[model samples]
Target: MSQQTTETTPARLPAAARRGGGPPWMGAGMPAEKSMNFLPSAKRLMGRLRPHRLQLIGVITLVVASVSLSVIGPKILGHATDIIFSGVIGKQLPPGTTTEQAVEGARAAGNDSFADIIAKANVLPGVGIDFDRLGRVLLLVMLLFAGASLLSWLAGYILNGVVQRTVRQLRSDVEDKLNRLPLPYFDKQPRGELLSRVTNDIDNISTSLQQTLSQLLTSLLTVVGVVVMMFVISPLLALVALVAVPLSVWVTKQIAKRSQKQFVAQWKHTGALNGQIEEAFTGHELVKVFGRQREIEASFAAKNDELFKASFGAQFVSGIIMPSMMFIGNLSYVAIAVIGGLRVASGAMSLGDVQAFIQYSRQFTQPLTQVASMANLLQSGVASAERVFDLLDAEEQSPDPVKPAPLTDRHGRVEFERVSFRYEHDKPLIEDLSLVAEPGHTVAIVGPTGAGKTTLVNLVMRFYELDSGRITLDGVDLTELRRDTLRSEIGMVLQDTWLFGGTIRENIAYGNPEASEEQILAAAKATFVDRFVRSLPDGYDTVIDEEGSNVSAGERQLITIARAFLSNPSLLILDEATSSVDTRTEVLLQRAMAALRSDRTSFVIAHRLSTIRDAHLILVMESGRIVEQGTHAELLAAEGAYHRLYHAQFSQPAIDVDEATPPPAVPGAPLLRQR
Candidate 1:
């Protein structure tokens, strides 16, 4: 018997692309930066941390204690400076001179300002530097600063755990969401784009939080603590330092607003570029065969350039915040210095107080600078958060019933009642289709490409919900049964075989994990897999590579068939299951399927007319309708659609073969040679 080749129709644009609202990169012009919802997205992102509130509270307490200790050190150091100054002024005085006499002497010299300062200093007339007193103050200052450092480090350690745990939960949610999404959703999305969201975007959120969360908390607390200390020492200078606060805030806000959009664009393009690269590499062999390497390279270059522009824009815009804030801080620092100096000279404030106030002024501005710099990281993280949230918010498949209808007595019968479905609203693919497969019967579906062959089986598998009708198994509506329960009773083998990177035994056991070693070996032998496995060095223990490139196409198909056999499902579906196998292996596979299909309902989709000769019922479909339905011989006698298809397969001339002479038959040779 000659084999017939089946060709699939070209893929159409995704539903989203067919409409005008596809991904940003798919549009003709340069991709536009999407406007960011910074506040709402940020709030939602922070909500992910709610479960770790107790740890956050502890972190805040530690930060406060640390900042308070750091703020007090400058004031104590100022006191040491006052002690040395008093000693120096008193040593210059005559022995036995009182504090009053020193003030009177400065007045007599026409330096009344110095006289007032000396009076307030309370310096002893003949005392030199007091090394003992200075030592105590210095030691206390060192201890305060050291304690502050320790507490800050401990706070950061705790916060790191909190951030990591929160991000881990977020990643879990994304993974769960992907599983719940419908098959059509995946069809519309690019594989690499979805991967970027799961891996890269989630990782970016983790890094941003780790780098900024603890530091931002500490900086804000430092700002509050320094302000309070500054007021205690000198209210006048504290007011001068605060004049820069509003200006710094305004600069950071304006710059962050612009950079937020760019950050969003940056990550979006990153996903698009990843999608392009994944497609190119996956089909690289086909690309080389068609000599399209230059075209592929050019496409990659364009996407890479778009990513570059977005990254540069995001970094450059956010980069302006820190420098602009520093400029404002410098202006305030100069003003406070001049005013504090005058206050000390006039004796309105002590010299030590002025020194401490200057230090506090710098502390205040430094925190503000650190915060401005962190804005960049925060914006990038929030952008990724928005992308993740979008996925979580997508429409999910309908939920299963709380109390699902059970299938206690196993009888393999399936019925479709006026079924209708369409990928797009305006274009219908299957409409009002009805069919019935009786218990323990083989129903074979044969059709041209895009004739709704796969769609019909997909409906039975509940991969998609019907538009206007219902499908049932054993008199129970599919919707009434849980998806897991329904799928558990069925086994499927597809034309495209999938094998994970694991031992051949592991791959076969994936179909039924609880199957015994004996059962696995039996199934393999039945499917002609044991013949090939025994030839390999490791036999059944041979490890398949990630791409499964180590196995021949015929071997891979046999393994998949063996997997289906191990399942031993009540209903079986084989879609072009033997297309990849050679003539000898295919014959063995058919015998295996025949045994497996005994006393079970089976749906076989095939293009080769010879394979379905024994099927109890044959359905010829065209343009989503069943044009003819009967036994293979009955349809052939009618000389209708099925007859024409069968004749076309056999009548087609062999490529490069003599017209009068038939091609020589060889064992294990392809029945239909390719042109």
Candidate 2:
């Protein structure tokens, strides 16, 4: 007979949706806006590079060498220009006349200013240009430029290696941290949002480091080298160039400050959006069944629009930085050009020196512009780093004992001693509950939803710890035994079957990897899984899809039961294990479980009264307390809570009393129940 199963409530809505006031996207639980700590986050990110200190030092050395060469090249070219200019003027002078004679002649012609320029130029009055010297200077300048390029490339190569290694280590740390976190932590965090932090945010950090690190380092060094060269050529021109520094700094600072918030919002929405998408896809069938496609689409559109706004705001604000810096730099450039021309004409500076200083000025402004332009990438990367760091800093689960107690025997005797637990502080679910199940007995638990039926078995598995009391196995406190040790002797088959994407044979073997082929086949036959496997084209080799959707629900449940049978555990837990199978199949499963339960303890949670009629002990639970405990006939005669539950299941119209009747008890089929 098929029993009617009531659908449980959908997952709890976000707090905002429950209150009935907020944007549609807020249903995703969008994170509240928090002020970004830019400097601290940036500093923390740099600290990730600490392990590569030696490599960084090498990179710095190379950059310094490269910048130095670059700085000196223009000055050498300027000297070559001076040589050419002086030779041209000397060639125009009268034959056999010295440089002093040319100056004297200009002065006598009442051209004192021109005479001063002639003196500063140091013209050889009777000589033409020195072609040999000019050629040598030119060749030397080309070599300096080439050497600078080579060193710069080498520095970038080493820096790239350092960034990749650092990011790799960071990924490994996040993965490890995830495993160390407590189960409750996962309950509170959406899987999609967590995935974004692990994937998208980390990728952003890697890209930021790759694109900005080398360029920022080179730009700053170039700025310093250019300034020094500028002062060497003419201190006045260098000071004029420096007037733009404060303005550029102010511009970058202001823009970065505004854009930082938008970047934070952008990534935050990205995670929220990913979470929505994940949930929608995971429950796609449920959505379609309820005709909620439009609602889901609306929610998605709202979140997408919010993300677009955040991304646009971040880019638009940071985009203003380059043009503003360029304007300030251009103003400085015009001032230097005017002052340099006047100085040259007045004989206060040589034409070659002025030419070189102009080059230095351009070099100075260009790097500043480059640095300013990189603000967008830097801010976005730092924002992502902050998210990744938050995950790494989450509180971890309590550690296992340094010295754990040993479990020498495989006896399945279990006991709960005055246990107390609650998911929340103010709401207690189970209080001072105690029970005992002897070895070789089947204990059946029956209860309505939220009656603490599943919670009781979960406690025995140590999926959670009790608030006030401890559980014991074979007279030993469960806490003293290592979790892995305790779990190794136990096997569980839940109502919701979980199977990985693999062949049927592989899935069955997952429970006991070392089990021989004969053992696997025996387990399959015992659970009646072999009956279905033989009908498939590939038999045991049939591949299950990732979602296990290719098989029927009853078939999936049978596979899980077969897996548990293969484990040969000392204790077994079957929660609604036979609910998905038909009445005939359930009869066969009951027979298989009877054989499997011989000389081993078992806990069965069931709503169908027919399944547990033969159990050794039946526990009737109500509001976290056991209201009745006894055999089916004994409880029916007593007319207690169990009598009411038994009568309720048989009285239902959908369950025909004759068809719902359980078969005669098989020898050694001991079990317990609570409802």
Candidate 3:
């Protein structure tokens, strides 16, 4: 309500260094190697999964069942082949004996044994094999395969539900963390990078959970089971297959080591690319005004190309792992086949045993290759997890007091007692500054840009804690009172007006949502906002777009003023609150502010000298120090900093106030001495 210039004055405002002085989109990209503690990160990742321990155990059990069932099929089929051979050679399982006992007895019969005679029995013409035994064996094998598949499906179903719920919890935690983080954290981080953490990084973990996790488990189980089967069938053949294991492991490790680096770069470039796109789109107007479309496109293309190269390197390197392991596996198979055949010819092994052994060898090598291929996806997932956990592990702000003192009586008596504050430890901005504003007084603060005017206000609001001294409101230390309690009694109107997407009535009622429609209308009328609202097609119901683009800048300022009026706080801080309105509109606003500030204490920060001529007291600041303070007449007589600033602002046709005709003053306004 105070008379203050609403015109834009960039020179009087300091650049926000924490925002990094550019589009929020121009933040640095992710580092290539943030940390190399893989084992620790992996452990933490598993720790997160611990919540679903039951589901994981289910998956493992199903995997074991599935692998065992699959492994049994080949052995069953091999036994059937042996039976058909016996039928052809006119030999049968010894009368009333099961196939197992007959085979063991024939093996003990040695060279030209009954096993060989029985195998030749199936060769006789018109000597049909027994169909009964073959039918039962085939049926059992089919049933085992179906049961294994059914278990796998159930395991996958359970895992899907578990993964989704786990991700939901993770996303919720990140959202909560954002609200608790201190202002400094946001200042140093990019909007897009934070977004990537929530969206991209978390999504990668989801994919790994849905696919890589299960695949890795199945592959490991297959490898272990096959190795055991190979040794049981024939130790010599198993030894030959075992040779491929070490070679596959060594090759996989070498490729993964290189691919891991590429995967890290890929994700890093992805974050940087996202940041550039966000910046370009958000500031499209500025880009066009400066004719920077080509430049932005160029920058985008460069980042995209970098991402492409990294992605290609990671994927291609991982892709080779499967084929390389297959080659070694095939070589092992050939060696095992030749050795087993020679042993069979010498009557040391049966054809069925040799066939089963070869099958197990193939199974053993397949899973090793699968595991190697999935290593890329797992590595990338771990990288993403590391970034997410880092955000969760960040240091939080100091906790609120368990029992805070209540701010009572609500007298707007504010005092700063030797306060000092600095954004950085080495560069002290405000050193031992002190001032006082009595109840029901209009105190004006005028200073050049970066002179710490805003910093002082920030300290009073406790946006940043002071390094020393204490601020008192109504004779009580501000720190002892709850922030919400202190802030509730004080109303603020910042220069950059923020009006969300909502109706005019809603925007005005934002400060006091519980206010009735009549109260909202009254507040709007006080600030002349009602006049404009009535002119709109929907009146007060007219919805404002994002950034309030539908209304002119002046109209937006009026609505903000209306919001402040609706709050009806005990104290007010106006940081060039009327800087956007025209001179005519400003005059109306000044009357509204006068009525609003009549009873409540106010601190008005302004750059224009004429606006604060009737203030009860004025403080002139320079380089974070209060250099002069007094009423207009007293400061002009002193002929100091305020004198120079006053004369500079009104050098032409200066109107001098006669002692006989005193400037107007609100009745009962306190007069505080300048120190």
Alpha-carbon runs more than 4 Å astray in model 2: 1-26, 29-36, 87-96, 107-117, 125-131, 514-543, 654-675
Better of 1 and 3 by lDDT: 1
List the candidate 1 regions with Cα displacement exceeding 4 Å: 1-36, 654-675
**Candidate 1 lDDT over residue span 478-499, tens digit each:** 9999988888888888887788
lDDT of 3 by residue, 489-592 (tens): 88888787878889999889988989999999999999999988888999999999986889999898899889989998888888888899988888888888
Q: Each model's C-alpha lDDT?
A: 0.85, 0.85, 0.78
> Residue 21 lDDT in model 2?
19
| Residue pairs with clashing backbones, model 1 | none
TM-score of 1: 0.92
TM accuracy, model 3: 0.82
TM-score of every model versus the real structure = 0.92, 0.87, 0.82
Candidate 3 yields a Cα-based lDDT of: 0.78
| Cα misplacement distance, residue 527 of candidate 2 (Å) | 3.7
Model with the higher TM-score, candidate 1 or 3: 1
